[model samples]
Structure formats: structure tokens, C-alpha cells
Target: MDRDSTLRVEKTTSLKAVVKKTYVLDTNVLLHDPTAVAAFKQHHVVIPMTVLEELDHIKDRRDKTVSREARIAIQMIDKVVDNASPQDIQAGVPVPGSTPEDVPRGTLAIYPDQRLIGDADVPYLDGTQDQANDNRIINVALSLQAENPAEFVCLVTKDINMRIKAKGSGLIHVEDYRRDRVLDDIDLLARGYEHVEGDFWSMISEVDTLREGNCTLHRIPRKSLPQAYPNMFVHDDQEFIAFVQRVDRDFVYLRCDSRDSLMHKRFWGLSPRNLEQAMAMSLLDNDSVDMTVMTGPAGSGKTLLALAYGLHAILEQNKYSKLIVARSTPPIAEDIGFLPGTEEEKMAPWLAAFDDNLEVLHGTDESCHGSITYVKERANIQFKSLNFMRGRSFNNAYIVIDEAQGLTQFQLKSVISRVGADSKIVVLGNLAQIDNKYISPLTSGLTYLVEKSKAYPHAGIMHVNGIVRSRLAAFAEENL
Candidate 1:
């Protein structure tokens, strides 16, 4: 071709090669997900120096989850810079992935506040006239946008107000880091059980019931099934309840016996007061299912059922060696300041629900007056903060995480990763009661685990309905 045509093609090629966008991250994004630096793939990720300062301030705090996350982000950036030359480190450095094969093609860049100090075109960010850290971060994004007009510039943060300010400041793009969100609507998530109208038992053709040890198994055609998994509960209008034993392409095998017999039977002196509670008890009683997620409102007995089962499993059945309880302590309105005590004592306030449930399970019998103490000692029950669960493994343990909705998906993964052989985990949470600003019902760790673990053979999920705590509690849950 002609020389001019070749030059034009080369110019177009270079523009296309440099067409990547720049994403400016806020401090909360790194605090939410420490590995966010590698999540941008082929784009450029910019971290304001103010974010580093924030991380430095939070790294030594008592809140282990946030503190650890800050340390991890700082270490990740340090490692990338340490491996590169001084010039490359200043300009940009490739973010290393969790695995060698997963190295991100993106570049990580640090933006200093000085770059935005004397810029005449940039204005102070929204909310205040002062030069706040958020304003400085937005200024860096504004500078990047002005410098690279050909590419898109966006700010990523978990803070809603900051997103609004960034958009108002004329930044084109803004978004929450939703890589861990497993569901769009928390209400539409699965409950791991299906209720059949009319008579479900008569619909089964060529049903064969056989006794297998302590369980009764029923075989039915696969085409007659409603979506189900092993250990999932199936109930009908006839008050007939059954558990799925195994599902094959040709037929579905169900254990026709009522595993809810445990619900009728006493568990640590507490009995299931409702159908949902019975379903939860059945799931916890079954030896085949190792992981279960339970969600309900405040007075629905989520924690009570879980703790009773944990006690029964560890103390009565000897199925597990110990009972481990953990939970996330996300604050409601404002910070409560530093709690003064040992780790377990510090976690006591968050675990008050456990104490209340244990009291109910122990009942008012004078002989069982020290039931809480007896159970805690005899069952080897241990209370732990979710913050320090990383890199530890639990074997032969019944682990129950209470108030799980406050946790992010990353925190849940950290807790779940610690489960070892001969261990079962029960995650209890009320999605409607989430207090963590960074997590919503749709993005909660409980919802994520319930959605992702649905199809697994060894996992089960149940969403408890109705409140059985008391008439007063039920009335308040409905009206106020």
C-alpha cells in the first residue's frame, strides 16, 4: 500500500493498544477485598497515597478482619514494587495474582496528593470545603481523566456517598466491587426445601420402600421430581415430610422416614417449635450433610436450633470432638470503641445470642442450673472471633457461625476454608438484620454460601420462617 495509508494504520493500532481504562480505588475497596488490585485484569488500577495512609492507620487495630485485610493489601503492593526497578515501581508495576498462572495483565499505579494540589481546573470534592482524603482521591481520579481523555476513568469504592460525590464531580464511571455477589436479589435465593401442594405421595409411580439400616429409602422416577439435592427436605399438604437420599438420572431415592423425629425428640432439653426449626434440626442431625446455611428473622430460632444441634452432636452423640462458635461483629450506627478483655471475653458481647439460646436449651430445672457451664465444659465449646480464623484448620468439630449476614463473602470464605476432616459447619444469619454498611442481603456471606453450596451433595440450606420466640416478640416482628 501507500506510505500514508501504512502510517494511518499504525496510528490506529497504537490508539487501540492504549485504549484501556483507569480505575481509581477507594480505601474501603481494598479493606473489603485485599486481592482487588489483581481483579482489574488488563486495565490500570490507581491507588491514591491517601488510601495507603488509611491502610497504615487501620493495620494495627484490634479488628482482625479489617486489620488483616489492610496488611494484605499493603504487602501485595510492597511485593510488586519490591520485584521491580525504581522507575517501573514509580510509573507502574504489574500486580501479581494469587497464583503464578493467574498473573494480571493490568498495571498498578500509585497517585500522590501532590499531583492534585495546584491543579487550577480541579475543585474540592462534595460534602465539605476542606481537603479531605476522599476529596484528594477524587482529585487524583479527575487528574487522570484530564490527562487521558481518550480512555475511560472510573472510581471504584464500597462507599455509597463517595460514589455520589465522584459522579457529581463529572467522573464518567463509578461502581461497587461485586465480584463476590452470588445473587441479585436476596429474597429470590434458594431455601433448600420445596413445599408441594395437594398430595405428593400419590404422585409417585412404582414406589419401592426398603429398610436400609436405620433409614427407610423410597425409589421414584426421576421425571417426577421437583428440583432437589441430597438431604434436601420435601414436604406436602398432607404433613408428610421426607429427605432426599440420592438423585440419579433415572430415579430419585428418598428416605421416607421422618428425620424430623429429632425435632419432636428433645435436644439439650429444647424442642423444635415450628416446621422450619424442625427442618433445620433434621439437616443438622443428618451425618451425611457437612455444611448448612440457615437464615431467618430475629425471633425465628436460627441460633437456638444451631446451638442445640451443636450441643447434641458434640455432647450427646459424640459425633464431633468440640463445638466452635464464631461470628462477625459489625457495628450498627457508630463505633463502640475498643473492647477491653481477652479475645473470648471481647467476643462475649457479639455472642450474647449464644448465651441466651444456651439458657433456653438448658431450661429451668434446678439440677441443670449450671447447664451453660456444664455444656461449655463437657462439650468443649469454644468461642472465637471470625477475624482470626484464617490459616487455621478445625478437625472433628461442629463449627457454628452466628450472625453471619454481617460478613462479606471474602470473610465467609476465610472461615469456611478452615474446615478440616470430620467437621461440619452451620452458618446462622438473618439477612434482614444485616448491619454491615459494606454488605447487603444480596451480597452477604450467608447468602453467597447458601447460593453456591446448593448443588453440593454434602451441603444443605434452610431459611426458617415465622417467629416462635414469644407472642410479644412475634407481634413486634410483624408490626414494629
Candidate 2:
């Protein structure tokens, strides 16, 4: 071979060695996580022009959560291409990073198609019309796959249908962005309680007990402890229950006055009907536990228990000045059009659960009706929209977020960030009842929070098992 041809062959070999897989991102992936752009690591990222158009449509939406995410994705792309000439953008731009080492090694580019790549026409799919945004995005992936036959190309999206359609189109590489998912197996997640074995009471009886107000603290050998969090429940077959106050290399400290005491303690005229509920009550009543996540099946009394504890903290214990209740307003069957009112007024429909629980707490008698009104007036309770909670801080308040399964990890972080000094936040959700299309039981904000915050000193997580609402509800939960 000629010397020049040998050099050309070496250059081509080097190029092939350094070639990285290109990931074409869908709009849903960006909306689900704004930081997904940075999550690709060293791989090339392609933003389809169709995705940008969809982002443009979503950027102006009234729903700040998704709208803001869309804007962030747009801004990130803009910033990357800010100083680059049109020609440079046509090739690719490097993603910005705080440090050179932090920067993604692969290039980022925008794919704008003047025409479809091949003779293959877009296929008709149910629930999606021809020439749909998802179809166009899939075509971009297909085009990339065709152009770079040697390098791998994948379509990343949160939408399951998009993944299915991409696979149907013969694009084998399709994946759900899983950076925010904490656990793949739902059963492996924390259940908030553990069964003790072998002379648990005698083990505790040997420890030094210190009584401080209503809570008694004891320290036992760390080896004797079960896997537990700060406010986790430790119980044996003898009906002995204790709260994990703290743990160290040598010993475990537990806070408890008497066995089964929390179950008997009444809050807002309600007592815990199950052992899990009792554990939840103990964590809720403890002011030291600033963050709590409760997960269970429907009719497990998760919300009712959390609300009762919030009221008790606000009205009775004076630990917090106000009780603020919020819930994700995900559409159940269909969205009821735009609401007309202030934030709290707009949230009234979504907060019907709060009112129903309050009514139950106050009773339905004639005299009780008057008392309910009086309590409502004096409770200093407020309803908040999660969208409006961004950039605001809450101090000396008990914040309860219901229907947390509908929230993404980013949404949960935004809500938790608003918790200021001397404030506590309780997250309640049924993982099986997740309503959000973009999230799953494993990827929901509640699951992420519980999994990540389990090690935090002031955070407690509990998964209530037994359904206490009714026998029928329990049967339905089991069978259905």
C-alpha cells in the first residue's frame, strides 16, 4: 500500500475505536428529568427537532413542573450551542461542565430532518395518528441508526408506548431513563419494621434506660439490633415495640415508654388499628423526625394517620404553627378542564379527602357540626398547590403531601426543599395506586424519598401493610 493510504487506514481505525453510541432523547425523558442531558455520561446525545418543537409547546404550559422542565432542557441546549456557529451546531457541541473532568466526553447535536431517511413510511398505531410527534422522534432514531451502521443508536424515553413503537420500527436499543429509580424490586424496599428474635425484652432490660418527658431511651448492643432506621419499629412476638432512636458501632438506642403504648394513645379521637399504624403514629408524634414517608395499599389509613398527627402537632402539641396539606392533582379518569380560583380555592376539589377525614375526626352530630366549624376556623390550616410551592419556604409548619405516588423525584425534591427551619414534612402514598404515566411504583418520588432518606438521621419511612378501612376493602386489595 502507498504511504498516504497507510496513514488514511490508521486514521479510520482510530476514528472507529473512539466512536461512541448516540442516544436520541424523547421529549418525555427530558420532561421527566431535566438533568437527563447530563446523565448520558460519555455517550453522544441527539435532540430531535421534533422533541424541540414539543418542548416549545410545553414550555408555555401553566403546569410549572413540566413547563419549567421543558424550559430547562431548552436552555441547556441553547447554552451548549450559544457560542458555536451554525456549522458547529450542525456537527455537534460539547456540553458545559463545572470542571473539565466533569464534562461529557461525547458530543451533543440536534437532528433536523429535511426528509425521511429511507423508503419506510411511518406506520399507523392505535391512539397515535400518522405523522405524530413520537413517530417523527422514532424516525430520527431510525435515521441515526441507518447513517451510523457501525455505532449503536438508542431511543431514550419515559413513555412505554414510544419504546414499544421504536422497537416495532426495528430500532433495538430502547430504554427508560432510570437515574431516579432507587429500587427495581418493590418487595426489597423498606417496610419500616422488623421482627425481633430471642429474648428481646431481656436484652433491653439490661440496657441503661433514661426517662425524658414521655419518651424513654435505652441503649443495647448494636449486634443485637435488627436492620433499622432512626424512627423504625422494633418488635418481638411478645408485643414489645420500641422506636430506634439512634445507632452506632457499639450500641443501639431505642425510645419507648411502654410496650403497645402508642397503639392506645389517641390522636384526634382515633387510635391505631394495626401494628404498622401504631409505628406510623410514633414516628409522626416524634418532633425529632422531620421527614416521614408512608407507603401502603389503599385503605391502610396512611393519610388519616398522617393528618391526625399533623393536627395533633399543630393544635395540641404546638410543635408547629400551621398544618399545610397538599396533594398531586393527577387526572384520575379524565382531566376536568382548567379551574378558576386562587391557589387554595383551586386545590379545594383535590383536597376532598382532607375534608372527609376532618369530618370524621369532628363527628357528624348537630353539636359536633358547630365544633367542626369552630375547629376549622381555629386550626390555622392551609391548602397549597404544589406548583406554587417552588421558591417558597415554610418554617414552623407541618406539611403533609398526599398522593405522592403521582410525583416524580424532581417534584418531591422541590417540595422537600421548601421545608425550612423547625418544619416537618410527611409524604403519604400508595405505590400500587400511582396515577402518573411517567412514573412507576419503583420510580415514584415516594419510593425514591424512602430509599434515599432511610439513612438520614431525621427522616423516617414506614410501609403500612394491613388494611384497616374495612374487611371488604382488605378483600379487594388482596384479590384485586
Candidate 3:
């Protein structure tokens, strides 16, 4: 942020027209969203030198996912502040706004938090131990707040504890970085179905019925299902279900479905155990839908449904040449190179759920092991770690990404973009089972996908909430 550049940006910017707030970001927020430095739009964005040191250390970590994000954040910061001198960097650097069409309003600066002096006016946390990095970053925000009493100085992070500490330390404005959040409440997320109190037709006063090939289509006024989107399902208590084929400004076109038809649908040797599974299976079987996002609680049978559909598509329908199963291994599991056969062999432990599903599908066979082995070979099933899935395209393949609640939006996008023509992807996640510390049910990539892709013509979404694993499993899911 050279003096001339800073003055030029300040003079030209319009959105800075609003009350400008200075935001000091934590290291976790950068790892969560690599482009967060520019997210402030017209406000001033500050990065503590301690955060840069943290990124420098984490960029070489064993966890490829976090390390990759750290590298990206460092690169973005470098791109913004490269032209500025060290002294200029401490002041600020000119960074681009959302688009070049909009005059850039934000200037990113690196604060030398370590060189803090004992200012009696500002309250600073001891940085010697106990989350030293977090304390230092909070100190920067405190320093900024004390220096600019008129302006709003805020600290943004994903860590709940850090936010608490900042607020306890007398910072008036502390916030979670919500630039990536798609919803305010996780429960407000799309469930792909609307369960009307009674029969669906009871409330519809006006409707125009038509036929499209073998499917019956009904055009209802948009006001009937005001919040409807494409691929959404509407069900009645009396057993009627309709798939929302498409939506427009004036109308919602629905394809009528019957409970008997959906329940009768089979994948491999498995039939729908419940309506939720049936709805999910319906999405999986739709050839026009290129992607499906399935989410539920544990023991809801998401993995089983995806695997069964993949096998049925490959073996019976000949929909694709192979079935590829992949998921993000725990960060520690990335060290499988220390004890592995092949990538597939190394990913076996993480992907054991798919095998368990296979056993359920072929448990009646005379030799269950033999049946599983034969199915794996015959279907060309491959187990892959999410780490190695980038830079590759799978054409004419069926892909299932399980346990996706742990992924960030950017990480999921990188994997989803690898889909080639003639390929379909089914993303499976149990939001309640999310393991990533930085992710939550509301911020999970699976949640983002469900919200963003619900209206996409070629994508489908479903929530299979039924716990069909066992009575004890259902009890635990509800009570424990």
C-alpha cells in the first residue's frame, strides 16, 4: 500500500461511502476461506504478522488440504502487497475489490503485532503462552480499536473460543467470518421435500395439467409452493408425492409420483426401506440429474443408498464404466504412505463403510467374501483418497463422495469440478457426524451445495432422515 496508491483508491472508491470498519482476521479464517482478505469489500482489512508466521509454518504441514489453503492465502497476500515496501506494507496495500468494474475500496495491511509497546489505554493479553498466536492477533485488534476510537474495529475468526476471548478482552465488535455462510440456521436448509398437512391437491384451487412423454406434469401457481425450487419434492400425508420438475416466475411444474411406484424402485438387490430412501433413490435414478446431494443423520443409510445405486447403474443399467468412491481422510490418515499397499489399499479403512454396505447387499450369498470381491472387480470399483482426486477427470463414471460434511466449500468445489462429461456424482454426508474442527452443520460444503444447487436443472438434493440401521442405533440417534 504505497501512499499514492492508497490515496488513489480512497479518492476513487464509492462504496467506502459507508461507515468503514477495520477487520483483523485470524489464521483459522484464512485457512477456511483463502480469499477472505478481499471479503471486507470497502472496509480496511488487517493481517497480523503473527498470522503470516503461522501460515508460513502451516504451509509445510503434513495435512495437504490445510497446507494447500495456507499456500493459497500466502500467494493472495503476496499478490496484493508485493509492490509495497516493508514500511508501506505495515501501513497498507491496495487490493482488488469484488470486480474491477467496481473501484477498489479495501486496503490490506500487515500489522506488526509482535512489536507492541505497553500502551496503558489498550488492554493486551499475555502472548507468552496459552494460545499465543490467537492472543497476539487479538492484541492487534485491541491496538487498532484503541487507536481509532471513532471507527469500528472488529476481530473476525471461526474459533468460538477466540471470539469469546476477544469479547472478554473488551473488544466491542467480534464476529464469526460469515462470508462463506449460505444460511443463518442449519435447520432452514432445503429438505428437498415439502410435507403438506393433508392431500397436496386440497389447497390447489387452480392448476393446468399436461403430459410430457410418459410423465404427467401439473402446472400450479407459484404462490402454492412459494419457496419451491427445481428438483424439490412435495409429499402429502395421504401418500402422494410430486417432484418439482422446474420452476418459473409465474408457475411451478411438477411431475406426479405415487408411493407404490417409488417404493417399488430397486437398486442392485436393495429396495427402498422407507420413503426417505425412496426419494433419495428416485434422485439417484434420474438420468437427467447429473449430481445429487444427500444429507442426513448417522445410520440414515446414505452410504448404502449411494452404493446400491452406483452398482445398479453400472451393472444393470450400464450407465457408466466404473464406480468411484472417495472421501476426505482424517488429516492424520494422510500419512498412509507410511503403511500401505496401493492407494486403494491405503484408503480401505476410511472407505470400509462402502464394503459394509456391499455385505448387506450380498449377505445371502454362499460365500459373502467371494461375492464382494467379484462385485468389486466386475463393477470396476475403485477407492480413492480425496487428496489425489484433483487434476483428474472421470468420464462415464459414477462417483460417491461420502462424509462430505467435513469439507469446506472451496475444497468440495475443487473435487466436484473434476467431473467430466457422461459422469454423475452423488455427494453423501451426515451433518451430525462432521469431524472437521473448522466446519459446522451450517458451514459444511454439503450444506452450501444443497442450497446453491437446489435450483440447478441438472442437480438434485435430498435429506434421508430415517435411521434404519437398528432399534438401538435409532435410540442412540434420538436419545444420545
Candidate 4:
């Protein structure tokens, strides 16, 4: 067939196809992932000039973390824009699915397209109101959507309210799950059941026959199962017991020995009470798991155990480069700036609890200020602000997110996405003491991380119970 004949054949052929258009990105999104700007191949990725301005402002901050972020953003733009032929910022960066011929370019659109859906109401220069940053991002998405009503205009943001606002404003929206990638509970069922010896129907009733160790065998009729895991097997030995699940009529659940399992062993100083430690270890033991959230009463050793595990990853296993310890700055009436000194000095109050844990781990010997410090000077320890985690890559690191219940979903995304190769993060907090009114224990970032990361191959979760700090402290935790 000739060229014309081939063209005619192609035109005559029938196939279902979908074409994607432009995607509007938020500044926070770019800060969260420097590579995100170039992520959309063959599709126009829009970065509003305002977003750039915000990047510039944040880039100039004094904080090392924010300043570093600015440097990265500047470098990315410089590399993309300066090296491109005629300065094609978008096209120079590789979009995953695009061919060489179909790469995107950073095209300039000075004015809003009046023909688009919501152009007439493009409320520009309206910064006096609340959530102005959010408003601009939404307006940009709305404007883009208005211009090409037929195309998909998604607002990609880490902000929960912004996501809700985008969805509420008749725009398609999604949070970036790239950072703290979550695994579903249903998918993790197969993994949770490491091994099973045939249809152990004979062993199901012999609950007392089971031993106390890593595997606990228990059988629950389909009715008594928790909504999360149905068809559970309840097994116990003379010493302990646990739950195993069955699905597809196969003996899919593996009863774990509760006592000697890696999850059951407690740290010398930070070992928690029964239920919390069990849950934490269950979540931790699974490399299939990605995120585990631990929340409970005070004196339950939540932070201590999390620190202990992180310390273990560093000192014993050498699985990560260093222990990265961080926490959300309390979002209460207190502000870091309001405190009476330098940033580190201002951070002292928030960091004292962490420091106290360190002291307990390795109390002052006049050699080092903290166990982490002692380890860092002797080995390698990384202590940073939650904000400092942005724009950097972490490989082989154990991240401990202390006071996690104070975090918003957006803040959580910022922290979680920084996980690099062979890294696991644990979030520890007590929801009852939450100071952020906008978030509850159930909706905190840590809770979201737990809910979302339940099924990943590398994540685990445990809720610390019982007070290990003191008898009175334990009493306060239980009774107060």
C-alpha cells in the first residue's frame, strides 16, 4: 500500500481513544516533588506565575530547609529554562509517557482565556480574603477548566481543604500519594498470612493446643470478624494468643507465635505495654507495609518505642543511613516566632520531649547531649525540622515523626514523600492532647497515614499501651 493508502486505512479504522490536556500544578506540589513539574508527558503542565513568586519568596527564607527548597526550585527552573532550545522549560524535562516528538513546553499565557468556563469570574487580585493562596490555585484550575471544558483539569495539591475546595468547585482534584504511599488492608491480607499448613480445620478448635510465640491461631466465624479483616482465626498457646485470617476457602492466615516474634521483643528503656507494642510490631515486621501510626495515652511509651525502633534500625540492623527524628511544630496558640530566641532555641520547647527520650536512652554522661547526638558523633544521626525534610532525598533512613497527631494531611504528605530507598517512617502521638482544632485524632495526618499505608509491603503499625514512665504516670494514662 502507498502512503496515501496507509493514511486512508488509518483514518477509516475505529478505535477508542482518550486525549489528555493541560494540568495545573500548585506551588506546594512542586516543592513537595521537584520532579513533579515534568511529570505530565504529552500534556500541558501549567505553573502559574504566582506559584513561581511564592517559590521565590519561600526560596529566600532564612531557615536552612526552606532556603534549600528555594535553591532546588531555582536550579530546576534554571536547568529546564536556560538549557532548552528557545528556553522550553516544560519540554526539556522528561514527562514519563511522552515520546521525544510529543514533549511539553512551558508556554506563556499572559491573559486568561475568556472563552473558558469560569473566565468571567476569574477573581484576580483578591488577596485580602482568607486562603488567598488556595483561591488563586483554584481560580487557575477553574480558569483552565473553563477554557477547555471538554478536557480534564485536575488540581493536584497536598492541602486537604484545597482538594475539597477543588472538588466542591466543580473541578477534578487529587492529593499526591507519591510520598507516604499507602497500601490497602484487603491487599495486605495475602501478605499478612505469611504461611498456612493446609485447611487446618482440625486445628481450628484446638485453640489451647497452640503455643505462645510468633504465630497465634484463632478462628472467628465470618460473623465476629472486624470489618477490616473478616474470617479471622483466633489462636493461643499456654502463654499468649493472636488472630489469623482465612479467605477464598484456603488456610490463608498464618498463626504467629506471640511471645518470641521480632514484634514482641521490647527495647530496654522504651518497651511498651501489651496491645500497643503488639500492633506496632505487627505493622513494623511487614516490609510490605509502608506507613504505621501509633497513638495512645500518655506514659504509654509511644515516642520512646518509636525512637527505640528507629534507634534499632540505626544501631543494630544498620538498615538506614541515620535516624531522622522530626515532629510537627504544635499548631496551638504557640508559634515558633513567638518564642524568645533563635530557631533552635525556639524549637527547644517542642524538642524537649524528644530530648528527654534521648536522655532516657542515654542519659547525660558529659560526653553527648543526647543518645542521638552520642550516636551521631559516634555514628550518624540526623535531627531536622518537619519543614526541613522538603526537597531532599533520604535513602536507608528510619524516620520518626513525633507528635504526629498535630499534623494536617498536607503536612504529612510533605514529610512522608521524602522517604527514599530502603526507608521506613513511624508516626507517634497521643490524639487526646491534640492542640490543632482543625484536625481530630481520627483525621490527623498520622491516622491518614495509618489508614492509607496499611497494605504496603514495607510498613507496620503498633499502638503503645500501659504507662512505662511511672506507676502514677501509668495511672494517669489509664484513669485520667
For each candidate, what is the lDDT? 0.81, 0.80, 0.90, 0.58
Candidate 2, residue 341: lDDT: 69
The window of 10 residues in a row where model 2 has the poorest summed lDDT is 120-129
Comparing 1 with 2 on lDDT, the higher-scoring candidate is 1
Whichever of 2 and 4 has more lDDT, that candidate is 2
**lDDT by residue (tens digit), candidate 1, 1-480:** 788876774334444454667889999989888888888877788888889999999999867788888999899788767778756765778776623565447888887655455555765454133656887888788878877877899889888988898889888888888877777777678887888999987887678777879877888888888576677778898878777887877877887646457458667767877777888887888788999898888899888888888887777788999999997665433223466767777778778888888878767858555867888899988888776778899999999988888887788888898999999999988888887888888778778888888878888889898988789998988899
Return the TM-score for candidate 4, rounded to 2 decimals: 0.53
> In model 2, where do residues sit more than 4 Å from their true spots?
1-19, 98-104, 115-117, 120-130, 197-226, 249-252, 255-257, 331-342, 364-366
lDDT (Cα, tens digit) per residue for candidate 3, span 1-480: 678876664446556356867999999999999999988877789999999999999999887788999999999999999889998898877777643656656889999887886677789888765656899999999999888989999999999999999999999999998888999999899998889997889999799999888988999999988999998899988878899999999999999888999999999889988998999999999999999999898989889999999999999989899999999877774576766599899889888899999999999999999999999999999999888898899999999998899999999999999999999999988888887888888888889999999989999999999789999999999999
TM-score to true structure, per model: 0.84, 0.86, 0.94, 0.53
Question: How many residue pairs clash in each candidate at the backbone level?
Answer: 0, 0, 2, 44
RMSD of each: 6.5, 7.3, 7.2, 9.7
Clashing pairs in 3: 1-92, 1-93
Please name the candidate that would achieve the greatest TM-score relative to the true structure.
Answer: 3
Ranking by lDDT: 3, 1, 2, 4
Q: Which of the two candidates, 1 or 2, achieves a greater TM-score against the reference? A: 2
Stretch of 10 with least lDDT, candidate 1 = 9-18
Best by lDDT: 3
True lDDT of residue 239, candidate 3: 79
Give model 4's clash tally: 44
Q: Tens-digit lDDT track for model 4 on 1-480?
A: 688876664347677654656667777666655566555655566666667777888877655444555667667655545534543443334333333554443332212222223244553323333647666767777776765777877776767777777777767655542432333332332122222244434444423233446545443343333332321223333444344433223223335445455344655344445644655665554464556667667877777776666666666766667777776564346757567865556667777776787778777456546545666554365556676567787888777778877765656777788888888777777767877644555545666665655433345545455677788886776677
Error of 4 at 353 (Å): 2.6
